[model samples]
Target: MSVDFEAARLASGTPDELAKATEAAIATARGGIERFKKATGDAAELLDIFDEANAALGNLRELAGMIAKAHPDKAVRDAADEAEQELDKVATDISLDREVYEALAAIDVSGLDAATRHWVAKTLREFRRAGVDRDDATRARVRELQEELVGIGQDFDRNIRSDTRTATLPPSALAGLPDDYVRAHPPGEDGLVRVTTEYPDVIPFLTYATDAGAREQLWRLFQLRGHPDNIEVLDRLIERRHELATLLGYPSWAQYVTENKMIGSADAAGDFIDRIAAVAADRLRADLATLLERKRADDPAATAVDPWDNSFLQDRVKAERFAFDSQAMRPYFEYGRVKAGLMDLTERLFGVSFTRRQDAPVWHPDVEAYDVSRGGELIGRIFLDMHPRADKYNHAAMFTMVNGKAGVRIPECALLCNLPQPGDDPALLQHDEVSTFFHEFGHLVHHIFAGHTRWSGMGGISTEWDFVEAPSQLLEEWTLDAPTLATFAVHYKTGEPIPAQMVEKLRAAEEFGKGIFVRQQMFYAAVSLELYRRDPQTFDVAELKRELQARYAPFPEVPGTWFHLSFGHLDGYSAIYYTYMWSLVIAKDLFTVFKREGLLDEETAARYRDAVLAPGGSAPAAELVRKFLGRDYTFDAYQAWLNS
Candidate 1:
């Protein structure tokens, strides 16, 4: 049923009155759970109670907002806000019941009888981690802290959205940039390129443009955005993280994050990073030497490689060696074809199908929704938003809107992408974009395949942050395989398959900038680690960045460029930036399994689905991975992949 804003407003009582109603509703919902435990109701009946509680929380939350809006008095609004908080506490408290929590944990997991038991066990652990067994006072504190966290995270993102500064440059500064790139820049009637911190205008100008001066100017504008005031925001976020972790009884935020991940502890996570870093470091240096040699060849006057020069030089080298430009490949990777290929891949691997639905609500005009099914059984739905728009999130991500529950409905997800539009020029996706689409589709398949049998909290993307990237990252490997690319990457104009020579060039050029690319990531992780490892007050972010760059990046670190100030991951990743690399080690090793078994081997794919993705966070990631591979997740495997 659709939520009726007008009806909700009319039904909403005064702050005090609505607070009482909400509390009563929560108690009723909790009572339903008790009755189910007493054997007075079945699993389905208990789920209805859970839904009722969810609805009550949604209603109370909405009512609180309406009351606050309708009231003129600040005191009344504050009271309404308090009422909302109380409702949240009640809902959270209900969900925290140890018996109720354990009962429905993995009830009907994914239409498979075995999955239910796994889900319950996983759910019980989640409750323990969430402090379900804590004393009332501790539980109350947890509720308050959770609300505070929600507010702080939203504030952090809001600050990023609102803080837009501009760098005005002369019209001559735009020379050598594409016509569209120059025109997109807000022109002062006097004729200057007004560059903001937006990606669409900045990225293209930085990468393909022949004008070195213009590229450097736009690069400075993009990086320097995290300056002055942004430093304070970053500091505040870091401080807040430290406080929250300490409050939660973890020694550091890293411990809290790693505890829930595949590595199982901070020490293990560190070891994993160190292992891959060692293997990748020497190879990276070799790669960097090649890039430098190429750079020297281009201009004997080029003394040092800077960040701005990295992408431009890399792209240039790619074209020279590969005879394959990503831009050239983009036209063949039509959004529809890329999407269809992903669906076909899923069907091959997991026996799922996706059909577009006409009557679905989407946030944007370009957004489309699909009904996903298995053997004609309705499993789940997914929404895809693939075109860039003003003020839209620029990165690709899959957001899980619902999670499966036993005796309850399955989950759905939204895959948000900022792809190029099909306009005057035909739309094409670069190989990286194709990989991104596959990566995100992996997440959707993981969530959608869960199919009605687990604690909602433990389903889909709720797994360990480090392990969370495994499904998506593993899928990225398929985008590189020649056979896999043949399924989709067709030329738009000629309808010819990607030529074999072009494929060879692409593979040959893949190692072109290994040193800079790998070390840049290492530098990012080190910088992030330094930011979190030190006290916020003592932190000089710029100095830390300089040290990190000197060690990892061959280029000298530019002063006054506080790039990390705009790093959104700092608010979320904190000390966990290393997790991405750690996960990649797992991904590369896992891809080796697929390669060994034949890339499209159904038996191996089925094993992966059953053991890894479909189980979600039901089993420990390490255990699941070990079970799937029939061996331990050894660092040696990762080192072998990296060195090879």
Candidate 2:
């Protein structure tokens, strides 16, 4: 039977309806667990029952979390949050159940296919990690820690989403911003302009606004989000994670989390961070010198660039040195055109088609839905929640609604982003926003294409945690390709294709900020890793953050601003923020084949889809890369790109 996108419980609009649906799902999952405990059947049959139960619970958890993050009504969001907490408690119980673990372990998997064998082995190992074999007291404590971690995580996210600080300034503060941006934010009756900490407001203001004091004010407000409250929340989070890790026989949460990932250990992740930092040190010095030089042109006494000045200076340098003004590209990136052009580009490259489903149920009016198909066979569904709303998630990500299991269910996902909303004026986007759209779409397509795995656990983008970002990062390269940009990058008014010279200049200008950009990423990665590696009770997070910022970044840390309080990844990604760079290294290597052939080459694209993305987590991530490259991936491509 085909999946009914509208029938999904996440579409429920009222809090009561959603709450009842969640309860029903929980009851059904519990019933399935009971069946699993008493079933007498072959290994395959028993495993199917186990996977089916888990898949149902997993899907409900994902949907509830999405609603918690994106739903418009406060009551519904609250209900979703409650549903998620309940679902997590059930999941934790299942993971710690001895009868379920022993039943699965006794199954004879020797005669099964490689994928099934892999699924069984990995499940058993995870069971062990859950402390299923421990004494009753230890197991009970593990469950408590896991459940508490969920609430702590939700609190961290809630504080950031709820606190949107705004800076009110005179009209002159809008001088260096684009005409469209100024039009979008006209002054109030008080004749003062206001900008919020949201991305749609803060990013452009930071990159273009000429008022140094105003920029610093906004930057400080942005950094101070979730402060004071999240400070204590984060401390509790780290302490609980450390306690959980020690209970599981690991020294720290970093070691516990990384043991299953491609990087393999906390020390290995740390070394990788240091290695990348060392390679970029020379470039960091050079980049900072340029920024300081440009700053001196305005303020002769200035010796260092402040955090607020980084973006403005980088944009200035790019325009002056490469003859590329990012503002010029904005007119061509009207939200509607960019959306259509992206779908068209993917259709040509991946041999898939997207048909808009206007009648599909959505949580908000701004969201658009589409059905994906290949050779006329419907494969998946996607929803684009591209614009921001109050109390919504403040970042871009792909959230899964349904995990595709062959012959059982089709994949469903959504892209939740906070780009500019179009109303009276054309909603033009910054070049980097265009890149972000492509990057998130890359994740959507990867999930759809890989969703057909035989086992539920192996379906969708379930690759090693550290390697999951590669395919999406690799797609960002397409945005910079001249031919690719020309396909959709036409001016909204004149309908003129973006000038080739402009594209050339943009690419050249993009290279100028590599060193500083990379080092900034390293600083974030170090903060994530070291925070989890240290003893939560003794170490001062602020001191550790200040030291890492100075060690890895060009700009000095702003005093009295606690950015770590708002670092959301510390909850979700925990110790693996290093995955972004690690995945980029592999992404650069994967792009080589396309560079050698052509960006739009169908044969090459098909091969890449089959080798790298199709297997999902059915195989180790390293093996997938080796299959595509005919050898192991290396940092050569990454280093060369960094230097270029």
List clashing residue pairs in candidate 2. Answer: none
Model 2 stretches with alpha carbons more than 4 Å out: 6-9
Q: Poorest 10 consecutive residues of model 2 by lDDT? A: 1-10
RMSD of each: 6.3, 1.1
Using TM-score, give the best candidate's number: 2
TM-score for each of the candidates = 0.81, 0.99
RMSD score of candidate 1 (Å): 6.3
Off by over 4 Å in 1: 1-144, 162-197, 226-229, 534-556
lDDT of each: 0.65, 0.90
